[model samples]
Structures are given as structure tokens and as C-alpha cells.
Target: MVQVHIARSGVQLGKYPEADIPVLIGAGTVRRTDHYWKKGMAYWLVIGRTYDPPAAAPPLPAASAKPVPKPMRPLRYECLRCGHKANTVREEKPGNFLMEICTWLANPFVGGLYTITREAGKKALCVNCGSEHMTEEVW
Candidate 1:
């Protein structure tokens, strides 16, 4: 039922329940560099030095073991020009520098939105040969 006080960058944030400190740390709300103090402490200590995480519990044995399923193979493509095999294709999109600069000068938010929308439309190309001509290979 102990409460812990937290401070960051020489500023005291607030006090929280001792049990919740681990959850806060796991969620990245509390940093290792932050200082913490609790009752019966002579001085504040760094959270990383003072904190001791709870041990993990042993896993329970299953009554019956099950067979593991095999993973599905990924689709592969072969470049017609270079005969190169690849599991993935690369995307290509031309950027308009003048429009981007103009929009950015007019409004940064609008420019970002316009860039995202413009970049969304792209053409898939071969990874090795950078060609649109490719044939799917079945194994």
C-alpha cells in the first residue's frame, strides 16, 4: 500500500501507487533516468537502480500436446529481363518538387497532406531489375 513519488528533469511530476510504477515504466510513461522516492527512504533514488521487476511464473504443462502447423510460403516473382528472383517488389513514384515547395511555403500541414496523398499512388516494379515486367513463380 506504499505510494511512490516521481520526478523528471528536476520537476516533480506526482505520486502514484507503488504497484502501478512497473506498468507506467512498461508503457514508457516513466523513464529510467527519472527519480523516485517512497516512505522510509533517506533520499530519492533513480528508478532504474531502485526498481526490481517481479519474476515470471513457470508455465503450466498441457494435458495433451498438439502438433505445430507449418507456415505458408511467400509468393515469389521472377524478373523477365534479368532472371532475378525476389519475394517482394519495390514501389516507385515520381515526386513534384515545385509543387511540394509551393505547398510547403503556403502551408506546412496542407503540404504534408498533399505529399502523402500524392505518394499513395505508386507503381510496383521489380526489386532487382527495376522493371514492371515480371512473372509469378510457383514452387
Candidate 2:
């Protein structure tokens, strides 16, 4: 049971069994450029030069065998007032710098909670006319 030391990018990953090295490479855990050192070797050597994957070894299984989900059509938006059509909307929120500073000076704990809740509340506006009145169209 020979053990091999694996290193990559100047950092030692850990020692792994010699037989498992090829399995690691197949699983993407080990790369060809990674360095390895074992007993009887004077210095470290690139794994690509020393190891060759066995031709009889079974190929790695697919990461995901499930069928992929079909792509969804992008949401289309039309501004009711301006009659502008667009696929994107902009988020509108007022800056709370002054309020945040005042709250932080009073109590840092409360200020952090207030800032998080305030930032999470956002209003989406139509990109064309910057109006909140918008209707969604699938097609």
C-alpha cells in the first residue's frame, strides 16, 4: 500500500494511496499539472508524466443524468401610462446614509437590523418610463 503526497499550486493537498491517484484524476479531484512524490523518488514530479489512465478503466458516470429543464421565455413588460415595452425593470430605493449613521451612533445592533430590512424592501420600476404601473405580457 504505497502512499503518495499530492501538491498543487505550491500547497500540499494531502497524502493519497497510489492506486487511488488515477481514480482521483478521473473524478476531477487531481489534475495533470499537480505534483506528486512517492517513496524511491528523489524529487516531486508532475502527475501527467508519471501516470497514465488505464484503458480498461470504466469512464466516470455523468454528473447529472436527469433531463434538463426547458428554458423559460423572458418576462415582457409594458408601461401602462407611457405605452413603453421593455424586457427589464430597474429597482428604485432612496439612500439611507443619514438615517444609518444616526442609528449606528445610537445603537449599532439596532442600526444593522434596520439597514438590512430597509435595503431588502425594493420597488421595481419600468425601465422605459420609470413608472411603477406596468403590465406583464408573456408573448
Clashing residue pairs in candidate 2, if any?
none
TM-score of each: 0.41, 0.39
* RMSD, every candidate, angstroms: 25.7, 22.1
What is candidate 2's local distance difference test score?
0.83
Q: Which ten residues in a row have the lowest lDDT in candidate 1?
A: 49-58
Error of 1 at 69 (Å): 18
Give lDDT per model, in order.
Answer: 0.81, 0.83
Please write out the lDDT profile of model 1 over residues 1-139, one tens digit for every residue: 9999999988999998999888787778888799999999999989994565565677878767677777667558878888777778887666776888899899999999878876886666899879977777664
TM-score of 1: 0.41
